[model samples]
Target: MEKLNESMAWLAKQDGSLIVGHGPFVESSEPPADGTSFYVQDFALQDAKPWKTPSTVERTTIREMTMRFQNAASISCGWLPLDAAPFSVVFQEVMSSIHSGIFEKTVPVVTETGMADQPAGFAIMAAMTRQPLPLHSYGWIDGDSGFSGATPELLFALDGTCLETMALAGTARSDDREVFAVDEKEIREHEYVAQTLVSKLLDLGNIDRSAREILDLGSIVHFLTHIRLDLQSPRTPDELIRKLHPTPALGPLPRTAETLSLLFEWRNRLGCPKQFGAPFGLLDEGKFDAIVAIRGIWWEKNQVLLPAGCGVIEASRLVNEWRELRLKREAVKRFMLPL
Candidate 1:
């Protein structure tokens, strides 16, 4: 534990430029479909599941030489490690330990929500440490669904005066069954997200709000609402990023506090990994960008890796939650799986 604290302290000291980050990937099944650009490799599991049809999925491995954050992305920090699940302990611990909010946790629901639990192949971090990452985050109960990618559609580069803080709020399913919009309240959660994101983005930038507009991302068929803002100043990447994190996709609604409490309050009990999953994919960002990191797996060591699920809210149906997790897992499968 002391070693973990020491590393966290060393990382907090700023030396490299602070920036936004995100992470991991899906299982080694369902290879990437056409149209998507970001696909990952679960190469570690190449030989393990050769005989299987590929629908197979599992948890992560333990202790390995990981260099994710300042390096690449890994699953070291997820729920598979200490078995504590980041319950209440993760949240408070992050505040004191990592100086981070957006507390994350792993929970065992009343029903089987299909999110990855144990782990599978390895996806370890193999880089060296750098500097503390800049961060800004928010969370809201998604009365509707789970995102395909962690903040799926990423938006970077300068766009006039406005900083484009946007994501694809991808599809949701557990075991391949839809979970999000069951009715009015459910669908409303996603709508709340569209507006909440714009508000959050504006809060971080020094720009005029009234001048904002809804722009097209890529495939119009994708069910997502994009919002762009004009920053009043050149937001040092750190500041801009800090302002755009933990959007409604993570919290703010009723269950948010309870959900958040799970991380900080019960964190110790869960006993998951240390910084390995802390900022899973928040390092090495471009100019003001936010990567959702929804569907992913942590590469721990040569044969150890872990996958996790995001618990939405009570409104989130138990069975539906299971399907959402499956979809998320499948998202990562694209690059990992093969013909």
Candidate 2:
């Protein structure tokens, strides 16, 4: 592995290629008409210039990218146990809202913090790049502060008139796969996401929804339903992102301005990173692929933050939700281990 000592951004595509952008990057509202650009935005979509023009761009295989990352030194990092009281409060509020008909489901986040012995960007990036298939590696780094992860959730991939996306929800340990598949609460949660996505894209064009299935990732698993659409007309990347982002998988069931504002409040109270669950995508010419920013680590110097969210419905229990959060965080930590 070669040592890397510069600011950069990258996304692993489904086609077995990695698009890397070396920065000092410039921000733009519109993508360059005939080249590659990275799309980054906070959860709130506040940035007007979400398109980043890298100083230079390269297309390479993930294997090649992995070789370029210098092996990060072994360093001790201690994490603080997340307090459950706050999450418990949020859970109760979410349940009340569901019962009152304001929301059928909502996802609330919990963040865990740690202090590392040294800067952790290289270590995190190296691990993410080495992740195996089904987990697309992605990240943005600028010196001491950045976030990186290998996420399983694809927001969408638009290539010409065809678009591909998925509804990924319902989590369980691999050991509980049998029971989880039959669990009513888990099925309902997954259905909420899959069905909502169908409704959102119905007017676009021909739609195909795959049979629900399980996606196994060693220790963790999730219910996955693939959805594809053939658009009646061309659509801009920004328009599509706005229409489908924050699906019930990660946002309120009946997404509304009011509900979104409330969800943001809960996220802020729990110290969730602004970019968590946001859409991170790449624009190559006219093609675009975006992934949900989850299962990742954020850092500022030696301070590290890990955030995970669980969908809460009336049938959800506080203890189970808290356990799910920890499970998600642990899965991310496993990425830091040597491949």
Best by TM-score: 2
TM-score for candidate 2: 0.97
Clashing pairs in 2: none
Model 1 lDDT tens row, 120-207:
2221111212211221111111112111112233433343355654433324433222333344434444555566566566555553
RMSD after Cα superposition, model 1: 16.4
Give the per-residue Cα lDDT of candidate 1 at 253: 32
Off by over 4 Å in 2: 1-6, 67-72
Candidate 2 deviates by what RMSD? 1.3
Worst 10 residues of 2 by lDDT: 66-75
Task: Give one digit per residue, the lDDT tens place, for model 2 in 1-339.
Answer: 244446788899998798889888889998888788899899989999999988888888787766665354555689997789998888888888889999999999999999998887778888888776799999988877899999999999999999999999999999999999999999999999999999999999999999999999999999999999899999988999999989899999899998999899999998999999999999987799999999999998889999999999889999899999999999999988864
Please list the C-alpha lDDT of all candidates, in the order they appear: 0.31, 0.90
Compute each candidate's TM-score over C-alphas. Answer: 0.44, 0.97
